[model samples]
Target: MKRLIPLFALCIGLPAAAQTPQLILESLVAKAGPASAARGEQLYRAKSKAGKTADSCAACHTDNPKAVGQHVKTFKAIDPLAPVAQKDRFTDPAKVEKWFKRNCQEVLDRPCTPQEKADFTAYMISVK
Candidate 1:
C-alpha cells in the first residue's frame, strides 16, 4: 500500500496529454492485450518488413523521438513524437488516428493493429 502512493502521485501529476494516451491505450487494450512500453519502443525503432526505403519509423522520426523529425520523401519538418518534447502530440484523437493510419500504412504496408497503436503510443509517452 505504501508503494502505491508514489505511483498514484505520479499518475496524478501527469499532464492532460497523458490522459489521452491512457484513454487511447485503454480502448486498444480491450481489443488487443495490455500495452507495453518496451514493445512500443521496439515497434518505433524496428525496421519495417514492408520493404519501403524508409524502413523504420526511426528513419523519419529519428532514434531520439524528442528531437524534431523530417519526412524522408517530403523532407517536411515534423513535430516531436514524445509528449515531453511536444505536449500536443497524441492529444487529438482525430490527428492521432490520421497519423497512425498514414504512418503505419507507410511503414507496415497496412494499417496498424490496436496492439501496435497502444504499444507505439505507450512508447512515445514514456519518453522523457
Candidate 2:
C-alpha cells in the first residue's frame, strides 16, 4: 500500500505534464478563425520579394488532408497542413517555433507575425 501511493502520485503527475502544452496550444488555436486563416493563406501565396518568389504553405505541403509531400530533397514533403496528422510532430514548442521562424522567412520573407502564426495554425487545423 505504501509503494502504491507513490505509483499513484506519479501516474497523476503524468497527465498534468502532458496536458499543459495542449492547453496552451489550444488556447492559441481558439483565438484563431477562418477569416484569419484565409488571410494567412493569401499572405502565404503572395509574392515575397522583387527578385525571386517565395514558397507558400501549399508549396511544400499538400493541401489535401490525406496527401503527403511527393518531392524528395532539402524540402521533402509531408502531411504538413493537417493538425491531427502533425500534432505529434509539433508537440515540442521549440521545434514549432524553429520551423515557424524558418518557414515564415522562406514564404513571407520574414518571420511570421503573431496573427499569421495564429491564422496559419487555424488553417492547418481546418484542413483536417
Candidate 3:
C-alpha cells in the first residue's frame, strides 16, 4: 500500500500531458483543411488600423514571386503562401508565435484564437 499511496499522490500532483507539436499542427491543419489557402488570402487582405483597408502583403509585392517590397526597408519580398518558399520560414515555433501575435492584432484588433492561428498556419502551408 505504501507504493500505491505514492503513486496516487504523484498522479494527483502531475499536470496533464502537453500536446506535441505535430499533433498541434495536425489539429490546426484540420481546421484549415482544404480551405486554408482561401483563409490565408483573407488573412493576408485583412485591414490594418489605419483604415486604408486591404492586406499589406500585396501592397509591396508584385505578381512575380521575386517582386520586392519598399515598405519593409531592405528585406526581401516575402511570398508567405508560395509553396516554393514555404519551408524557408514559419517552421520555427517562436517565429510563428511572434508573427501571429503581431499580425492578428494589426488586423483583427486582438490576438488570434488557437483555432484561428491553426487555420491560418494550415492555410500558409497550403499556399506553397
Candidate 4:
C-alpha cells in the first residue's frame, strides 16, 4: 500500500502532455490490438485521394523522419515528427488528435481509424 502512494503521486505530478503518447498509444492498442510501424510508413507515404490538390504526410514531412519538413502549400517550416528528433512531438494529446483529424481528412478524405493512429504513432516512435 505504501508503494501505491508514490506511484499515484508520480502519476499526478506529471503534466497531461507528458503522459500523452503512452496513454494515446495504449488506448489505440486496446482498440486495434497492436500498431505496425511498417504499415505506418506505408500510410505516411501513400498519396491522398485528393490527388493533385492533396498532400500526403511525406509531401510535407519528407521521407526521412529525422529531417525537418515543409508545408506543401504554405511553405512553412515544420519540425520533425520523430520523437527522437523532436522530444515534444507527441507530448500533447489534444494537439496529436487535432492534427490527426485534420490531416486524415485532408489526406485520406476521411477520419483515420484508431488502428491508423496507432500505426502512425508507432512508426513515429520507431524513428531513431
Candidate that scores best on lDDT? 1
Regions of candidate 1 where Cα sits further than 4 Å from its true position: 1-19, 51-53
Candidate 3 colliding pairs? 82-128, 83-128
Report the candidate with higher TM-score, 3 versus 4. Answer: 4
> After TM-score superposition, what is the CA distance of residue 19 in candidate 2 from its true location, in Å?
5.8
State how far residue 41 of model 1 sits from its true place (Å).
Answer: 0.6
Q: Which lDDT tens digits does candidate 2 get at residues 23-101?
A: 3345345444323657655654555553123356555564454467543345655654455665654455455668888
Rank list by lDDT = 1, 4, 2, 3
Per-model TM-score on C-alpha atoms: 0.80, 0.59, 0.51, 0.81
Kindly state the number of residue pairs that clash in model 2: 0
Candidate closest to the true structure, highest TM-score: 4
The local distance difference test score of model 2 is: 0.54
List all candidate RMSDs to the true structure: 6.3, 8.3, 9.4, 4.5
Residues 13-88, model 1: lDDT tens digits: 6422334555655555656788899999999998978937579899988999999999998999989889889887
Per-residue error for 56 in candidate 2, Å, reads 1.5
Task: Give all candidates' CA lDDT scores.
Answer: 0.79, 0.54, 0.50, 0.78
Worst-scoring 10-residue span by lDDT in model 2: 15-24
Comparison by TM-score, 2 against 3, better one:
2
TM-score of 4: 0.81
Candidate 3 lDDT, 15-51, residue by residue in tens:
1233233333554454444335566566555556542
